[model samples]
Target: MSPVRRGEKLPIYNRIGVLRAERKMTRAELAETVGINVQSVGALERGDNYPSLDLAFRICAVFDLPVEAVFSRTEFGAMSAELYRRPDLRPEPQSDPGGAR
Candidate 1:
């Protein structure tokens, strides 16, 4: 294994595993759909290998999503967090609640 690089441009994170789970699709299934092998699918999902532009586009097409929706340069937050963001997590308004400012 190679050392993990930080603050660099090479790292790429993806939501392939999450999307596959949502659709109940197996690695082999995805591999077949994308014209790759099972091991390559695993590699992509594990972030051990990066996909080429064509492969990335193919994967996005498989999920009916855009490239950014499937891949990111930074780490992704929890799927649920993105799906159901809490109102309380938002920045509070600066106005006085009691109206006595």
Candidate 2:
């Protein structure tokens, strides 16, 4: 697989690395579980290649996570940032104290 060009948008982004780290799973271990080469796992994690639908399903099964949680077309921002984001707590713009034209 070709390396993704810098600044090029990938068709899909994955949480494989995060998931592996969370589960303390090595690439070889995950590869064995998914019946793929270890290098393929690394490539998938690095966004060098997109997974086939079958492979995607296999990966999700290995992680026990929904496809949406494992992969997304849009970039998934940092989990901590997303979890801590406070939209409602954002300060509203101060209204004009006096009604000026």
Models 1 onward score TM values of: 0.77, 0.73
Residue 87 lDDT (model 2): 75
Please give the clash total of every predicted structure, in order: 0, 0
Off by over 4 Å in 1: 1-9, 88-101
Candidate 1 lDDT by residue in tens digits, 10-88: 7899999999999999999999999999999999999999999999999999999999989999999998888898777
Model 2, position 26, has a per-residue lDDT of 99
Q: After superposition, how far is residue 18 of candidate 1 from its true place, in Å?
A: 1.1
**What lDDT is reached at residue 46 by model 1?**
95
| TM-score of structure candidate 1 | 0.77
